[model samples]
Target: MDITGERASESLMEDTTTEGSTMVIKMECTDDQPQMRENQEEVEKLKALLAQKEQENDLLREKIQTCQAPYPLTPETINNSSVPNYFRYCTGFTYDEFNKLCRFLRLPDSETVTQTHIPLNCDKLDRHTRHMPLRQEFLLVLIRLRQNFDLEELAFKFQIDIQSVSTLFSLWIDFMYDRLGVSVWPHRDIITKNMPDDYKAEFPTSFAILDCTEIKIEKPSSLLVQCEIYSNYKSTNTLKSLIVCDPRGSIMFASALYTGSTSDQEIFRECKIKDLLKGLLQCGYLKRGDGLMVDKGFLIEKDAKELGLKLNIPPFAKSSLRMPVSDVEITKKIAKHRVHVGRAIAKVKQFKIVSGRIPNSMLVNINEIWFVVCMLSNFQQHIIQT
Candidate 1:
């Protein structure tokens, strides 16, 4: 009975040991299953992240390719093409004429002209981006003047942003005005040399023909400014300038722009023409017998007489309904002489910026633009036949 009881106890101990080992193995398998699921989830997340990075890289490569693509309208392409074609298209000048103008201005070759030639406050310009060459800047100004293209259009044509176009246009306009404005007003001797024989025979003592020209502008927002620039003649808001031209239709002097409401007489006085006349007298460019042929608008007869300068204005019939034949003949002669000044004004207005209503944004540089246009007109073929 004792042996049988001992055998049963040993069998029960073996069975309990086997059940404990099985539970321990099952727990280890369950823990490993959860760890395997977590590792799979982690691997899926890594793959998703890698795919997203590759997509971004593809998009970046596409952008780089687009940026690197050559544009046909780029400055380099234009320069590489026939200079005559671009010169006439870009600047209204023939190749020979353009090169002659450059030589006259003491500028280097067009390729060598760069932004460094002009002084500018370039703090706002991006240093990382490549800058447009100087000749391109010059061409930009001419294009703006010749074509009157706005900033956006110019930006597209030049393959640059609008801000760069604006900056370049403004800086180059001021630079050109500073460099070329002085040449607009030449000495009286040069004017005399170029005077046409018709002018000499008709008005032997006349030095210059004086006139006023009006340029239409966008109406200002302010009521006072609107009133100040409103013109009765143009029936629109305008800016006015006093212009004097030699008989050869070369602009000798151009006054700073005045409000269109101002009269020719007011412009004459305010522009200090009397002082200019005084200087001319002192320099012997004008003597006692020298005259400034003017239209009736000038009304400076009394003031001019005080300075010993004759005011050759056409006779106005204050009371008569009709003038005598002699007076009519005199009016015809005066009108004929005055045509040269009108032609000079027309040449300056060929730059469409001044020909059309100027935008208010451009008002700040209007005077400078006016000076540039007038000065550039002198470089063109003379208005009157020599």
Candidate 2:
């Protein structure tokens, strides 16, 4: 104990020595090591937190930009996997038929639908966004035509405004018309090859069954417009057009929409369907004996002979006590075939856009709308089986 006390006394007495100074320095470094480690750990945690917050903020900002657009392109439900399966009920086309329509129109895939675009007629819908796919827009237009949904209904369903709907309807109709408007009259040999026995037995060399259909329209406000569009026969304002279909009820040609008061013969003259027939005959689309059928109302018998095509119109009855048996049989036969053209037109009218009273808003683009409806009718089950 005496020796230990003597050593401690000596150690204190030498506190200013170099060895004691080194010992003090080592102790101080050990004390600071823990604090430095703790600070480094805290700095790493703070960096991780800041990185996480930055990612969240970036995502939030992107979504906000989408919401702030005037005409948001994001579809509410129609363009995504959540869309319903009742597409046919809404747009008058099944998925398969819609796909076929895309292929037929040469429209782009939904992934890159903006490849070929129609110029917007107005600035309201000019801000194209990724909200709605082009395929969905096509369906919207078809649904409007098929179901006759009001603008409000379309807007709520499509998440767009009424003006957008009107503009889209107008633009898409023209786009479809531009692609599908080409005449497709089949050749004589092609017709004969597909001729059903019913037609073969009656009229072997027939080309088309021609008729005129009138679609009622809203009464115009201007007296001059009213006078031009009022149909004396239908006793209403309407639009008329010539529709030509093959024996199988496939529409071959359609004229532009004319004033409802226009005569069938006038449309036939103006539509150039007669000229087309002449060209077809000259180009061997019709053989020497090939003829087209028409209702007796068309006064083109003289023109038919000049064009080197026969007319199988029903015979007219003279002012006699009763019709002859031959004329009656002929009328019966012609009437049976004529029913197809009427059925084709009726099927087109079933679309309701052209079937119901057409509003004046559609008057300017009525011709293209009419053609689109008529063309879509070909997608249905064939009206005449054979």
Which is the leading candidate under lDDT? 2
Would you list the C-alpha lDDT of every candidate in the order shown?
A: 0.78, 0.79
The reply for model 2, stretches above 4 Å from the true place, is 1-85, 115-131
lDDT of 2 at 306: 79
Please report the TM-score between candidate 1 and the true structure.
Answer: 0.76
Best by TM-score: 2
Mark the regions of model 1 whose C-alpha exceeds 4 Å error after superposition: 1-89, 110-113, 128-131
Residue pairs in steric clash, candidate 1?
Answer: none
Backbone Cα, N, C clashes tallied per candidate: 0, 3
Shift of residue 144 alpha carbon in model 1, Å: 0.6
For each candidate, C-alpha RMSD in Å? 7.5, 10.0
